[model samples]
Target: MDYSKLLSKTVVDLKPSGIRKFFDMLSGLDDVVALTVGQPDFATPWHVRETGIISLERGYTYYTSNAGTVPLRRELSAYMKRRFGLSYDPMTEITVTVGGSEAIDLAIRAIIEPGDEVIIPEPSFVCYEPITRLCGGVPVPVATLPENDFKLTAAQLSAAITPRTKLLVLPYPNNPTGAIMTAEELLPLCDVLKNTGVAVLSDEIYSELTYGVRHTSIAALPGMAERCIVVNGFSKAYAMTGWRLGFVCAPPEITKQMLKIHQYAIMCAPTTSQLAAVEALKNGDGDIEMMRAEYDRRRKYIVEELDRIGLPCFEPKGAFYVFPYVGAFGMSSETFCERLLNEGRVAIVPGTAFGKGGEGYARISYAYSVKHITEAIERIEKFLKTL
Candidate 1:
């Protein structure tokens, strides 16, 4: 069987996810304290879960319209407006997706064409670059520095833009690094993008998990929404990762085309999940607050612990992960993580898994309970002493 010849060359060439590699390694080990994945440790809010249960009990297991139910869309519309001051027509401008990941893929595919270029800021979530490549679009990675607090600057954005540039992925509050772009920080980049004919995919799945300051969507900025697709979901905020539901909000013209892809590829998001999401949007504010407060506590503890142990972590203001520098140990990010896993029994992802920009750092997720995080920190500290 000549499987190599038969398989899609692009899929064959694409590297397996770096984050998942460490996660998979854990399955063979016992008694290891792992902080590799970024899923919330909290359960889905009881009310939201109850809603899904009720929908199932009522025999609501049927397919929905390709764009999802009208009621769910309306709730999504209201939720966006209430939370971020963004407006989208429920009927024509919003399409529910399998998850924020799917929303990202749809937006990129809907816009990117062969030979186009996507400007991706690295040390980010691992999806953007590979997804762009799968679309036959070239990925241009711009390394966001720790000195800049990992935020992408206007100068960097300007330098990356070319006539071939077709889209820019704005991932914040970011994964792996936990960096965020405040309105003041985003304004300069927005100004640079105003006439560039480049669309923006603003992945804000962590919107409700920020600390000290609220999240500001790039689409909320003046003149930006017209060219931006806002991707968000119930995963982080509502602890609904298993629900497998997310949504995209964009201009009608853009969504009209994205829907065609969704109709053919997905048909619709899960019916039970969509109905449950309606309840989440309408009544899950308190759930978000409770979980976020706990995450904030964990965030502070992890950052302080890393610094105390001489790892020099960047204090993350958003998201649930911290990217701590591991270069002082004179080991590659992968080697550092491998040693931590094998010797310390504490698992974390290497920064190089994200991109070249992540070469000297490693990501530690604070999405676990204080006790779980404390155990991992102790193991890490013990491992550092061996250095």
Candidate 2:
């Protein structure tokens, strides 16, 4: 039997994630200073951890409600209202998920049918396109420009649509580019979406990490709430990545459908994580603030250092990553990343890992200690001089 022929075409056609290959090559290589992977270096806050511990000490381990613990859902609803001015009916609009990852997967599976097209802005999160394909949808990647600060314009949206477009993945405070869509930026896209049948899968996991201005959601735009699925989680905000917890809020119709897929695929989110996340929702405001402040400080520092070293990166508005152009060095993004790892012993992901629009760039995450950040930049600067 030919193993290659045995695989499904969808699995065979899928390209492996470019980011993971570089990371795999760098693993256990003792000298590399990595700015790869988008996760906060901070530990989960003590109180949040304590809540999980206390639950375990009392032997509270068991399967939770299919939606999640009622207490957590209630606190999550209140947390959204308090933090983002979005009101969700905990009983009808929310479904707890494994992570923002699972929330994204569930959202696509909930609505897309074969031949449906999912509009994805390039230089955005990688998962959107692959997951869309896995759900039997065709991914239509619209290129977002660095000149536009990587925000997708209304014209782009208008041009990308067709009768089969079932959804758009709105990844703001976005991953590799670190670009965010302001209220002004989003409103016109909302207008473009106004009468269309397409739904928006808004990933707002980075919403709480913005500096200076608040993050805006497409769901918050007038007339969008009913047509949007908002995915957020405690991973970035509360440093709970390993805990694997997240939630999605949408109109009851969509949520009801999403719940069916989630219920079958995940059963429920983690019980211990749900209990601790309740504490996070109730009292983690200070922890969010502290982490945001630290990221901002590093954000400013890295931008300055990169400029000082002649990299000239755009100052990222939100999230913990910086994307700097590497075109001047006359190397492909993959070659640059590979050579950087092999020569300078520094790890970063190629921008093309995101999409074609990211060809001449590389993504460096600031989710590490300042000392590590400083050291990484210093080495990067030295590496550039040799180039």
Candidate 3:
């Protein structure tokens, strides 16, 4: 009868996701060309799916070890070393979780105490700030500028840190803006972080989706590995969103603590997914390249089309979304997207859904087909004419 009084105030007060808000608006609409979701349009590779099916056929429906199967962790260890040049003791440092979302939650919960301030670069993936609040940590959002390609700056990080600083969430090959931090760009932020007692949660879920440049993990940088918790998963890279699997690699001391949370909360990632992920790490390199090449093609087409339509877009070198400035039309980001959806039947997310720093822009995911994107952009062009 009084559910509001019974609910956790934090959960009650948390705003629903801005992305979902717009997506829900499309439920009853017909003939809408939507570019709102961040997931790849590609299905999971056939081999990867067959691996899971094979495991099920063998009746391997039992639970796994709290950290996941040893074979999976070992393969994950080798994959990390091979792809990113980062080394972690598979037995001690890596714990498989339900997804990258859970790994991020475990990392934040493990490190944050009440009043501990976590510095987040805004216009990022939507989870970090609200998750920090749930952990009783204060979220300090530093706006990354469009002029700087939305990359978090060393100066910004240095200024944001205080004696109470506990963590910095580094989400790159970032969501919403598609901004990425190169090794050289990350070096300055790393410099500022040295000896600060602040840990880094590097969310590299889109690591394999960059165009024209290889993904660099901040964990691979000198002295950074010990202080970083690297969270990655198969969802974006392998089109394995439904698998609900991911892993976190951190120093043993830190992971030991995070494992306690995972053990109590999740038990383990899905057994079928773990076995399939091993196959993905071992033989799915070709699948990654094939899908990434297609994403790169769509990325280019959407960016060019948006610019051609007079909505100046920042060329995204990483991730599969393009954020174009929509301020010239003199509407708030939400209003711009809402009007487009209602009047033009083109669906895109408003940047303000990500954070206040995203006020003047809107995010359009290029994760759909070239044909789907073409239709959406053509509709956008017509919408702009009316504006």
Candidate 4:
């Protein structure tokens, strides 16, 4: 059985994420301290958990509507309004997804045509490029730089677009780099987009995790609401990653089409998780505040520690990862990450895994407790001296 010949050429050609290799190597290595994965180190809030428990106890275990439970959608609509001043009609403009991961996949698959180009800003999320390729669209990576604070400049966007370009993957409050696009920074790109037919898929899963400033959505920009599909979830904001729930809000026509795909591919997001998300949407502001505060403290400490150790990193304004320049260490990112894990017994992801622009750096997640982060830094300092 030559199973290799049965796979799609697109799937076969795609390179696996380098981050996974480190995870496989680190598995069961008792001596290593891992700071690789980006997940909140907090439990799901008690009230949200209680809602799920109550739902199951009350025999509410049946599958929800294909789009999701109506009440959950309504609560999400209100939540979006209160937080971002964006209004999405629950009945027509929204579809519940398995996770932000699936929401991204659905949006790309729903709109992108064969050979169409999807612009992805690098040092952003890992999923955007590969998923775009998988959907028979060209993955056009726009490399971001540390000199630009990892933000995608309008000039970069202008250079990346072509007549075949059909979509732009907007991943702000970015992973790996922790870079966020400010309102002012986004205006020039928005101006360029105004005259183009290219659609925007704004991933705002990290919207509630920004430090110091309120996160801004492209959907809220004038004229963009209708052209954008906003992907958000309970994962980062509410520490509900395990709940496996997310939603997509887009134009009614697009939502209708995406719902068809969602209905066939995923009958519905988990019922208990949807019930828990309702509680999160309605009453989780305090939980968000407390978690954000804790994350900010860790964010500051990691940046300061990295600077003190001569790693020269950009102070991240949003998200919980610190991307530190490792060019001074005189090694490729893959070699650096492997040696760091094997020798220093501390796990961090090589930045190159994010994209080409991510070379010469590494991503350290602040999603752990302050105590673990402190120990990681101390170990890092010891490791640096040995180099």
Per-residue accuracy of model 4 over 146-183 as CA lDDT, tens digit each = 88998888899989999999999999999989999888
Q: Is candidate 1 or candidate 4 better by lDDT?
A: 1
lDDT of 1: 0.93
RMSD of 3: 0.8
Tens-digit lDDT string for candidate 2 (1-387): 998889989978998888877778988698899999789999999999999999999998999988888999999999888888898999999998998999999999998888999999989888988888888889999989989988899999999999999999998988989999999999999999999999999999999999999988888778889999999998999999999999999999999999988888889999999999999998999999999999999999998998899787888999999999887898898998888888888899999999969988889999998999999988988998899
For model 3, what is the C-alpha lDDT against the true structure? 0.93
Which regions of candidate 1 deviate over 4 angstroms?
A: none
Clashing pairs in 4: none
Worst 10 residues of 1 by lDDT: 36-45
Task: Find the number of clashing residue pairs for candidate 2.
Answer: 0
lDDT of 3 by residue, 1-387 (tens): 899889999999899999888888999899999999888888999999999999999999998999999999999999999999999999999999998999999999999989999999989999999999999999999999988999999999999999999999998998999999999999999999996999999999999988998999999999999899999999999999999999999999999999999999989899999999999999999999999999888888888888899998888989889999999998899999999999999999999999958998999988898888889988999999999
Query: How many clashes (backbone atoms < 3 Å, residues ≥3 apart in a chain or on different chains) does model 1 have?
Result: 0
**Worst lDDT 10-window in candidate 4:** 13-22
Deviating ranges (above 4 Å) for candidate 2: none
Candidates ranked by lDDT: 3, 1, 2, 4
Model 3 / residue 147 / CA error / Å: 1.0
